[model samples]
Target: MPGGRLTHRDRRDIGAGLAEGLGYAEIARRIGRPTSTISREVARNGGPGGYRADHAHLATRRRARRREAIPHRDPATPPDAYGRDPDAVRDFAEQLAALMVRTGVPRMAARVLARLITDDSGSLTAADLVQRLRVSPASVSLAVRYLEGLEVIRRVREPGHRRRRYVIDDDVWLRAWMTSAQQHAMWAETAQRGVDVLDPATPAGARLAHMSQFFATLSDDMSGGSGTVEDALTVLAALRHAGTSLPVAQVATALGWPPDRVTEALSRAGPDRLTPAQLGALQGRA
Candidate 1:
């Protein structure tokens, strides 16, 4: 049989001859392979002068494995070699943002989440977000505020700095549960009011009552009580302190309200909510 296939060792021996300036025909003859087979192998991997049998063989195997892992491709064949291109990272970020948008996450919120996921530190100062995302400071501000409301990320501040940062935590989903509980409470309250207004003993009232009961149970399961409340308060308080870093106009725009309303909400939430007015006020003390 014509030596149609070569093992890694065989390829290595053949490559060694070429490295020593032997002709392909001579090397192939020594390795008991066809001259054309040897020539094609070296050329396909790297030129003959740069070929390494082990490197080429591994590359071939890796491509085959990657292809096989794709499921649509043949198990025995390799795919293309992987590269450490920075463009790949950028593509990943864009793909992630697109995926999030598809999942009913608002565009701006999706952008912020995508950035947080891609960030090395799992957080970014507003300025960093503005710069990296190539959007205005207002966009980052608004996006971050919405994310906060959704209970996905918390805000943080650097020591002695006027700028605020946003962060996603290990317990993000746990806090999300509390957020769910709060929402459920609102819905339960609304449904309870409807039952009271329409007659609690009626079939319609009974259905709404059942709705209230369902949501209330889910809310209780999610809330896990005062401990979680305290934890959320701590994060929001830290964020309120950081909010001082935001400009008044930016804060107003982010909250989608007048500055006065912003001030009122901040004051009402009292050092507990991470509102801009509180941050601004806290900064004055420093």
Candidate 2:
């Protein structure tokens, strides 16, 4: 089995196999390589139907030359690498961005998020993003704003600096999830209101009522307010009411929840350390 990089001859064979209508696994087996290796090579180049061995080989050589030509100018830090493969991180970033796009994330925002997460510095100015992504500054600014609106990224001011940089942290996903649940609740409320205005016995009113129920159910599921989640929240509320940190055993005892349930509830509720008022706000009561 060939464990090293695919040779030009291998690519030609792959192209031939594709022309012969062979699946990726068949081609890989014939070439003595893993299916995934063959799959990535094919997908990265031009995909199954469009793949051309000569064109792929040339493109590969061009990318190799570009990497070699770019000098590593950061003396204080070594080149980014994953197990000595400097390009692995870049490849992963693009792959992640592509996956995000496929899963309904806006393309520009996905690209920007991927770049930010892969950056060694963990933050980037709009100008820095423009340069790195080779996109217009306006495009970067718009993508950044979209991410900020979703609560998936933050803008932080650098010390003694006038400009801000964008960053992502663990809290980002939590906030985004909460924001989505909040929106669901808002939709539920709007739909419920529509039912009343449209006459509850009519077809339109029935549709609106069903819509309201659907969103309400989704909101409850997302916010950990139903099923086992309801019990967990009750435990959380009790703990918060104590006004001081309590032991896991004590919390479990007070709420009649299992220790494991208490632990999970606290993990979801804490970290951000939501006060009673904040919790109320999440539920749209405040």
Candidate 3:
């Protein structure tokens, strides 16, 4: 429907919709804008409870002016090899950084990650980051350290270069996901300990127990072995097709997998973790 930056009237409408407790989708529908537009607008200004039309309009104008003042590229920088527009690329990076900020990443760290990931090499030295982000070297160093702590980026030195580079690997997200799962598991363990220390029958203990269970389940789901869900599902399907319990060796042979690999897959789809139907299918085997 409508396109371009939101007008002051649109911000007023968004404020009215928030006041009425309308959802983002409903507000966007009423204004002929995308739901994401409404969501980001509200999120950028304040949350639903604090959003003010005038404040939001002013903030948007300030952001626009700041963006306008930023240089898109350096004169010494080469053109994109694929001929993509530098301005568009810069805008997309900013959008990505904003989205990451909304998802709980610190603003500087998010900007660093966005810039690194958007680059063709997925790597940048502190100097490169400082120059490109127009931030101090100390700022880039802090951001990279934060990102590294999350396991989403790592430091490496080029073969002949003395300078260190912060590199985002292709599997950066996978590493970050696993890091999160590990954190959840740690929380689950701590919560369980709290439950024991407080006596499980007490109200506080019960709350801790629920918290422990929630995080434990989340950790299990997110921390599955190196195999993907598709691989696990395939193993389950093979068991289902067998119509009777098959030993690991037999299933491995049937699936053309090595014995150890099949064993790993079967362990991942353990009976205690399977659905009723899946459990029934593999009843005789562990």
Mark the regions of model 2 whose C-alpha exceeds 4 Å error after superposition. 1-84, 230-286
Number of the top candidate by TM-score?
A: 3
TM-scores of the candidates in the order shown: 0.44, 0.59, 0.60
Q: What shift in Å separates residue 100 of candidate 1 from its native position after superposition?
A: 2.9
Q: Rate the local accuracy (lDDT) of all candidates.
A: 0.72, 0.80, 0.83
Worst 10 residues of 1 by lDDT: 73-82
After TM-score superposition, the amount by which residue 14's alpha carbon in candidate 1 deviates from its true location, in angstroms, is: 47
TM-score of predicted structure 3: 0.60
Best by lDDT: 3
- Model 2 C-alpha lDDT per residue in residues 60-176, reported as the tens digit of each score: 887677657767555344454544344556566666676776677776798889988887777889888876765678889899989988878999998999999999885767878
| Model 3 segments more than 4 A misplaced | 1-79, 225-286
RMSD of each: 21.9, 10.9, 8.7
